[model samples]
Target chain A: MIRLERKFASLKENSKKALVAYLVAGDPDISTTLELMHQFVLSGVDIIELGVPFTDPIAEGPIIQAAHDRALQANTSLDMIFSLVEEFRSKDSETPVILMGYINTFLANSKALESIHERGTDAVLIVDVPGESSLEDIGIQNKNIASISLISPTTDNDRIQKICMSSSGFIYYVTLRGVTGASNLNEDEIQKNILNIRNSTNLPVLAGFGIKTASDARALSQISDGVVIGSVLVEMIQELSEKKDYKKIYNYLNEISAAINP
Target chain B: MDNLRDLPNSDGFFGNYGGKFVPETLMFALKELEDTYDQLKSDPDFLKQIDQDLCHFVGRPSPLYFADRLTKHYDGPNIWLKREDLNHTGAHKINNTVGQILLAKAMGKKRIIAETGAGQHGVATATVAARLGLECHIYMGAADVQRQSLNVYRIKLLGAEVHAVDSGTATLKDALNEAMRDWVTNIDDTYYIIGSVTGPHPYPMIVRDFNSIVGRELRDQSIEHFNAFPEAIIACVGGGSNAMGIFYPFVSDPEVQLIGVEAAGSGIETGKHAAPLNDGHPGILHGAKSYLMQDENGQVIDTHSVSAGLDYPGVGPEHSNLKDSGRAIYLAVNDKEALDAFHMVTRLEGIMPALETAHAFAALDHLSGKFNKKDNIVINVSGRGDKDINTVATMDGISLD
Candidate 1:
């Protein structure tokens, strides 16, 4: 089994939920981002999702969009992200690292993608490509790296089945009917949709999008196997980037992790 | 080439371009739109309503005026203008907006959203939304909001809210990004009325079909007025709606040549232009696969053009296929050349062409010797220059204020 499968299996064996933390690569700077990765792991993050910045992040809200802008301004590239993952692997190889980005950026760096498995990356979630389009459909074929798929509140039952069947790592259930950082969390709707997804596939379902607080993560984790936090942590990173305040971020991650685990 | 109009396939690929490269939240919406459009495209009541609006409301059948002075100045083909400048809202944008708003009404959407560059499309969409009594919102780049303030006021006067998008390059692409985000957020009752022949799947097809009225009218008008088909058809391509509007009907006509003019802001060599077909490679932007002005890192770079409408990093997917297949010839003209054409056409033809349309007129300077004196050369004057006076005056170092 791959790293993601093993990680999820271990979590299920322990009867615990997973906590995924997302940060943009090269945001602020490269060395700081690498340090943040180590810090995230130390803070009890089960999975690391590194955002590969693109010029137009249409799916993201203002906060994450600003993060992408800062990352691009720092000249982050696919090679640098891969190397970051490789360096992270040197210290801690247990946790799975997923690269989340737009389609064009991955398509532009197909060579780097072909070697991602060797470079310690586990999965990829391209926001624009969606479930109907496999990476292979767009002329990208890598059997090693798991292809993650998203199921939104707008996704119908038929598309949900299709998306779930093709997805590998885990089913990402968008908690609300909005972009990242949108605050409206209809927990009832999220629970219903996640249940609908679980009926179709046995893969672990993780709720993401609009998940901000530890309470939100804990509530979502009850209905699903895990929860992915993105925009809020990215916002905090930007706020504390100048001061290099990793301890505060680590504490916040620890609080969220403890909330989800119990 | 045989089934040129039957392109974009069931999967929305014009050969190798065009597809749904959007987030998962928008997929069902795109599919729903495609299904709805397929049902209503040939419905008699829908067709009748669209026809009634085109004839009565929009004042369709805009005259095909022969520009005698412009022809004489070029000393080549007889220059004829397909006067889309005379359409409702002062541009051809209403042709697509009217059809889309009707679709929105049929779909029971209570809100309408759109993105604009020069604000002509925003005004057109707002006009239809006001007519239909639907809530309307227009997203425009902050830079373009300042450059096209006249049309901005026109859109607001039509009772639509205008949102100045101050993100990215603060241009059309950024406006499109914000519009997509809004649509994803409010997918239940909101209908996004895409202005150009761009975006994912059904949008390019729907916009092309609605705007295809231009070519359908031109076909009969050319034979009626000239007694023969024009030797060439020329139009300016921003996201390529106007050019595609005229080129679709004549794609199978072996005798007639199709020409698309792209905006070269300074020069393509200067690396500050929007001539994607001329100087770009195949990539994806705003949900469609097309020729894009992007860096090696796959990041879309900023594009430049005096005409705000044409300052985009990518062209429509069909245009990319056309360029690859040699079905249409693409050319580019610089800002200085377009500015010169702006003055020349206003003086010689007594018609002030939009800065975007001036790019098409400038192509005559390059194709001057290609046609005989008797050959008819039809050009799509896509919009009027009333909105561009401020920019032109500022270029001459004079402030209208």
Candidate 2:
């Protein structure tokens, strides 16, 4: 079986919904961001989405934009993000790490996407190129990490099928019509949407975008394979940056993870 | 992290503002600027050269003046003006254009190209190209050419070619599309002197820092005039380069109100305005997401402002942050009011402002009569009326009647 399929089966056998959390690499401070990642996995985060901030992140809102700013200031590069993954591996090797960001950042670093994926990232979600078939069609094919794509309300059945065929790990189904971090919800609509995607592929359909609370995640997991939470985790980091100890950020996520499982 | 304007650790931010959040396309350009500018600032060699050039070439210190009659006309409070208009190229734009042109020359770039809306920046580019003996090309919307014919003539006389852009709305936005296209096409051999603090990364940061001259001069002048800083500083926001330039120095001074006037060509309620902070939704535009006017379907919508310079749908991301944080309050002024301010300032102060500056003039009523009184307001008279003489004359139903 494929590695992504294995990951899904393992989580299914354990009766645990995979918890995926994202943070822009090198935000606030580089060392602290890495340190916080180890803390997050320790607090039961199953997968990490380490975002590489691009100069132009059209899909993101202001909160993520500021995170991009802090990361760039610390001179975070594609190579640095890989080294960060390796550094995190030294402490913990079980949890999966995904490099999430724009394609331009990798294109600029002289490192091809496939080569960088070989450094140990388990998956990638190129926000702008969602469900687009460029990864396989392009000269550089990443064999190690599954290329994840997002399906939104705007995505049609034909495109959804294509995304599912191209997807390896899971199809990220964006819940809202707009960009990430929006607070609007329509469970009936979302349940129907995820069902449409699930009908097309046996691959797990993970829901993302504005999943802030355990109730939201738990509600989503009922219909979907799992839930991917990002902005809420990022906002939690920003709020606690004032408190000075970033290690405590994982504590916030710990509560959310327990409530979802409970 | 702490708001520090001073440098042992100014690093990249300006009092909790200014930092790089850009892609790698601009990293070379931004790093080049940071290193070279730090050297040029204190290099006694470059300073003496630019200072002498400013006096004999671009005009020095611009001027600090009191627009007393214009102040009295408002019927509320005293208004002091920083006469950036009197500068040789006719506005604060020359300050940035000159600095960039010099940097381009030092960096060995032989060709200079720019994008403009009202032709204010085009004239500045043409002026610098003439002084530096470099090849110059400027792209302006075809509509701006019809409106500001004399500026078109002036640029031609300076021997620069003006490419009439016909894309998008066939105005400022189109001109920017053409300019960016030109830069990307010729990145190896050309220097793209972006006109405002709007564009991708380094630009918003670079342009604001260069225009910081206006803020520095005003801070000293305000202390000289009112024995302290003014209660408020108002500037029209197109891309917000001028406002950021002046506002950067005062961002941390909690007592002073930093007012940014955006072009509400029609009232904000009319759905025809370019007030990014007031109405724009968050989405990717140009290269970054600050605020952008988008359709209900989430597609970016084209905007209209009688003033060509203020005719954009989105604003710089930095300005977006300021609006969100409450560090600055933005207000909008419509076309009729701006036209009225154009004629009013021309008649009262004998100064004709660029249509973009007229947006600042339109906010006087919003400032004096309606808002708090006993507040000293310093308006950056960003440009001269010379370019807008025909615009004002046509609106008055007389070409000197």
Candidate 3:
């Protein structure tokens, strides 16, 4: 089992909800992103989803798109992102690191999968590539990293079964119909889908998309194993970049962590 | 060539390209579309209905006119213009939109969504939605909305809601992303009418099928006019729908040559052009694996063109496959060449061709010495140029009052 599987197993054993925090690598700059990864662990984040910035992130909302532009302006390539993960792994070997981005970013670089495995990337979530596609087709099946799959309310039961069967690490259930940072969250609908997904597979299901407040995370935690806070953290990072205030980011994540764990 | 009909295999792949590379939220919707299209494509009743619409509504069998002046000027092959420009809504875009709107009606989808670059697709889609009495929404890049104001107005005048998208590069690709987001959110009630043959599995096939009438008509018309098949067929490649429409029927005809013209903004060497087939590598973009203009890190690069329709970083997957298979010849026509052809056609034949279609005309100059005088070459005049008059005027420094 990989670090993600081990982390989820440990979280389930302790009856604790996993706190997954997401930050775009090189959002303000690469150095700040490195500092924030360690800060994420300090604030009790169990799994860190480091976004490898691409030119077009269709699934994201305005805030994340702007963050992607900032990261691209800083020239954050896949190599630099892998180096960041290697540096983070040196300090904290236990925390699961998930690199999330579009498929082209991964497929463009010939050595991307090898570099990912070499740098200790525990999981990868390509937002555009659906569950119907296998890791083998994407040229990452035999690698050490787990290919994370996304499930949404619109996904039918038959496809859900297929997606669950192919997925590794965990199933990320998108809570809303819209893009990331969309405000509308139907908790009852999400609960029903999560139940169906849980019945299909034993893999831990994590709820993401539009989880803004601690209460939102707390409520989402009721339906799944964990909650991934992306747009909210990205928004905070954008706001904090002007001041270069890492403390605010730590405190914000601590609040979310406490809410999910409590 | 015999396997042309069995393409895209069972899993929506066109030989290592084209698949469902969308978020899971839209998977069921894509499957539904695929299933519905599979059933309806061969259904005699559905085919009959679409045929009637094409004949009476879209004005099918748009005349194939011989461009005498253009042919004489080139001192080469007898150039024939397949007049898709004469279709309703002033472009070949209606061919696919009309077919898809019928599918949407058959699927009982009450809402329709589309993305546009030059607004031709948006206008065509909106016109069909108005006729069918369905709610229509069009996503256009903010930059495109400003540049193509006439088309934007036409879409709005047709009663469709036009959303100005201001994300990414603020162009066709970004507008496509917004439309996908909208479709994912409203998958239950909405049917997305993708303008080009560039999306996931069933879309490329479906759009090509709808637009293939251009080639079917040309085949019959060519036999009637020339007593033989044209030596070569040419069309402009913007997401490659019009080209694919005209190219599909001829794929099996080994004796006939197929050529696709791409926009070379200033020049391919300048790195500003949108000629993906010439300069791009194979990669996945906009739900299909195709030739895309992207950086080493896989980020889509900003593309430029005189025609908004061709200003995208990627080409259709089938075009990519055709290029790889060496079945089709792809060439780039820079803005100057296309503009010169735009004027030449207007002055020579009294046909003001769409900027996109002008690229096909411009290729004649490049093929000046390659063809025999008796060899017939047919070019798809994909649209009329009225929507582009303002742009042409602006470029010529002639202020449009």
lDDT winner: 1
Per-residue C-alpha lDDT of model 1 across residues B311-331, encoded as one tens digit per residue: 899999999998888989999
- TM-score winner between candidates 2 and 3: 3
- TM-scores, all models, native as reference: 0.99, 0.60, 0.98
Report fnat, model 3: 0.83
- In order, what is each prediction's RMSD in angstroms? 0.8, 18.8, 1.3
lDDT, residue B147, model 1: 97
Query: Model 3, range B116-201, lDDT digits (tens) per residue?
Result: 99999999999999999999999999989988999999999999999999988788999998999898778889999999999888
lDDT of 2 by residue, A1-262 (tens): 1435666888899887777888988887678778888888888787788888654454555577668767776777777788888787777666778777764454344345556655666787766443645465423466777878787765667767887888777778878644457677679989999999988888878888878888898888787877788887777787777676765567767876886677
| Lowest lDDT 10-residue stretch of candidate 2 chain B | B1-10
Give the better candidate number (1 or 2) by TM-score: 1
Candidate 3 iRMS, in Å? 1.1
Across B181-216, the per-residue lDDT of candidate 2 in tens digits comes to 555335556888888887654566768777887888
CAPRI band for model 3: high
lDDT of 3 at B303: 96
Ranking by lDDT: 1, 3, 2
Poorly placed runs, candidate 1 (over 4 Å):
none
Candidate 1: pairs in clash: none
Show pairs that collide, candidate 2. A55-B22, A55-B23, B352-B385
What is the total number of backbone clashes in candidate 2?
Answer: 3
Q: What is the lDDT of residue B82 in candidate 1?
A: 96
Q: Model 2's DockQ? A: 0.02
Best by DockQ: 1
